[model samples]
Target: MIAHNNMKSSPRLENEHEHENEPNNLIMKKLLSRCWEESRLLWRLAFPALLTELFQFSIGFVTTGFVGHLGEVELAAVSVVENILDSSAYGVLFGLGSALDTLSGQAVGAGRLERLGTYTQQSWIICSATAVALTPAFVFATPILKSFLHQPPHVSRVAGPYARWAIPRLFAHAMNIPLLMFFQAQSRVWAVTAISGAVLAAHVALTYLAVRRLGCGLRGAAVVGDISHWLIAAAQFAYMRGGCFPEAWKGFTVRSFSNLGAFVKLSLGSAVMIWLVVSIGYGSLEFWYYTTLLVLVGLLKHAKLQIDIMSVCLNYEFMTIMVALGFSTAAGIRVSNELGANRPKETKLAVVVAVSTSAFMGAIFMAFALIWRTSLPKFFSDSPKVIDGASRLGYLLAVTIFMSSIWPVLSGVAVGAGWQVPVAFINVGCYYLVGIPLGILFGFRLKHGALGIWMGMLTGTFLQMAILLAIIFRTKWEKQAELAKMRISEWGGKNENQPLIS
Candidate 1:
């Protein structure tokens, strides 16, 4: 009887254990399914975003390639001019437009689709006016380059005229950035990708004709660039006007022009509410930080050679940045949308998925940078000296590429959460206060030149990355969701549907 009872009890215990394991297996399966689903959603957005960035980047890449063959001096001059324009006008406009990524994204999540059009139009107004105000920088680029930045006179001469010619492109960016963000907020990435790809193809053919076949020189390149940009602006504008987003875009209304001051205040951040900072100037500071490297390189002893090599490296860096920007866009969209929908857990999951994907991609790019260190610069330059200098800087570029994979995503997260003001302060502290000074110290004082300057800047970038990571880790996603709803309410968003998660 005792042996029979023991046998029965063992079987019952085994059955109980099996029942416990069932839940564990089921949980594991559910987690894996969730991850797979999240990945699918993220890539759906990211792949198109990446293609859009690549296509857009190729326009500039093509320009550089053509411009490079003109002569090293021409390449150097154009690089300087491009840097200035990017740091100044482009930076300001892009930064201001980034607010749309947050605002429109949240609006969509909260089912306030109609507000996207108003925000976009308001962005256009602000950026256009800002473009007008910033026009003087292009007009007087030569004097500014020579006197203020201490660039070579000949380089400045070429750069100034080219900059003035490129002014039309500046205004084109003013119109284009808002539209790009507007489209991106709604996950209309494929549209952007298709349009950019078409424009890039046309741009390449036109650039080849103007610069290589027609021998139109720098002026021709500048004019072609202007045309390419305007084409993008016009195409995107037409798309928006074609009733694709009819509910969001209710045709152009006078209402967009009505709340100009309030809109500006919101876009730039309210000084009255210092705790909730959202300064668009963060973009300017970040852009200027990279531009400062070129500036510093120009001041080196072998100024021309330094400029050429640095420009080549910077161009590659910028290309990689476009990839990161793709991730950044996806991250920002996911975070903003999830928060707006009151799905804090999903937002957290989205961030994890995005960062993981970006990290994987970054690793691939780092390997590519390392492997093709010497050969990569050949695309942009024929100079052996330039090639060798860039090759030496390859490791730095690889590290930067890796860091960029994560950094921009965090920035996107910040943008999604409307934490631009804090990040802007971080940018100033890291890039300006720490990086620039250390660069000057290492480059000039220690005679390290471009390598040392870049090292210093990378240090700042690292610090910025670390701090942002910490912030993201410590963030209470639930509170962020609450903040998102509050922000939408402040913006007059009317939620048409109940939230799925709180």
Candidate 2:
């Protein structure tokens, strides 16, 4: 209980009446209590998510770090290919995976637990089909890289083999993403955390053996991820079958294949929204290329591969920063869950607490970036030139991290509120219409290089954040709660393709 006496309580019996008359004291007490309560809720949801992102990213980071050691060619090949994959495939596929967040989170809250399994199964079909369609891109990556990207011949050659080797990742991605998203929606993330941790360790060890001991080179490094990711997918599937989700997983059913059209439309909105959100801020590696073309065009041919080193260093920071990204995911789930249950006040509190916590996390990242501005590059490479280059990029990295801390939670609110279709269009406007064109102007016309490009992206981010704030404030929370309940009833009850009657 709050110390009511700690306030300016009038000691005299006559003055004691003044305390009760003022009323501000009680208001303050209630405000403080609500903040404390909301903070606890935010932490509980975000922390496990933080662990899940950390472990998952660690496995990929280790694989990248291994490639960073194998020579400049390997570094350039792996980094660029990974960058392309992130931009083209990962964003779309993972965004589709996030569809589970929308369907299952609300389902759990609305007490429609059995629907969670069917939703997840529906995602598998979509992601699998997507993976198959995209696999050919990897097969022909060499031609695309050489013709379109203008990379050096050696980089193209090395990337070709690795691209083919990396196709298995898509298949594994198909299996793994839905499982993790299903677990996350239900808040059964400790299982994901443990499984990811084990996978991280195994991935690191196997990558060392493949690259360092067995001399697998770039192809070997890529293959290690295939093994590691499949292992994770298999393990998580086992856990699901082993009574982890007794209510949700009612074995396999034909219902999963029943809602293809509905699932596709929903997944597309989610994919586009998430892709735009992630690509503009985090996924688009090609952003660096535009800057290089602008500022370093004079030395382009001679220094084609130099940008890879900087990319590697930048990827390192992005990977570690994934922990902060968890707030967005958690916010999405909590907001959706509360809304589904028709708890309008609870939904609003979750949003407020999530935004506040994310801002605090951003400040922490800003501090870390400033302190380790120089020393942290040493973790990725020993080249003094690369280290010095990365050090110079530190200020930008810090600002990026700070922005990342806030923007994601806003995106989460959009996700939780069932505004995916509208948000996708918003992202395109913010990222492509405003961000990219302006970034190009800054990088090319202003000759500010990567820093200027990032500045443009940051401008877009804050703009998006501002618009999201407007929407959130304008939203009728009670109406959204009602919508969530109705959506759950409609989607959970019958054929998703059929139009709902008014």
Which portions of model 1 miss their true places by more than 4 Å? 1-10, 272-280, 495-502
Q: State which candidate has the highest TM-score.
A: 1
Please give the TM-score that candidate 1 achieves against the real structure.
Answer: 0.95
Which regions of candidate 2 deviate over 4 angstroms?
1-17, 21-23, 268-306, 494-502
Q: For model 2, where is the 10-residue window of minimal lDDT?
A: 290-299
Q: How well is each residue in 106-205 modelled by candidate 1, as lDDT tens digits?
A: 9888988888888888899988998998899899999999999998888999899899998898899899989988888899879878899999999999
Local distance difference test, each candidate: 0.85, 0.73
Worst 10 residues of 1 by lDDT: 493-502
Error of 2 at 361 (Å): 0.8
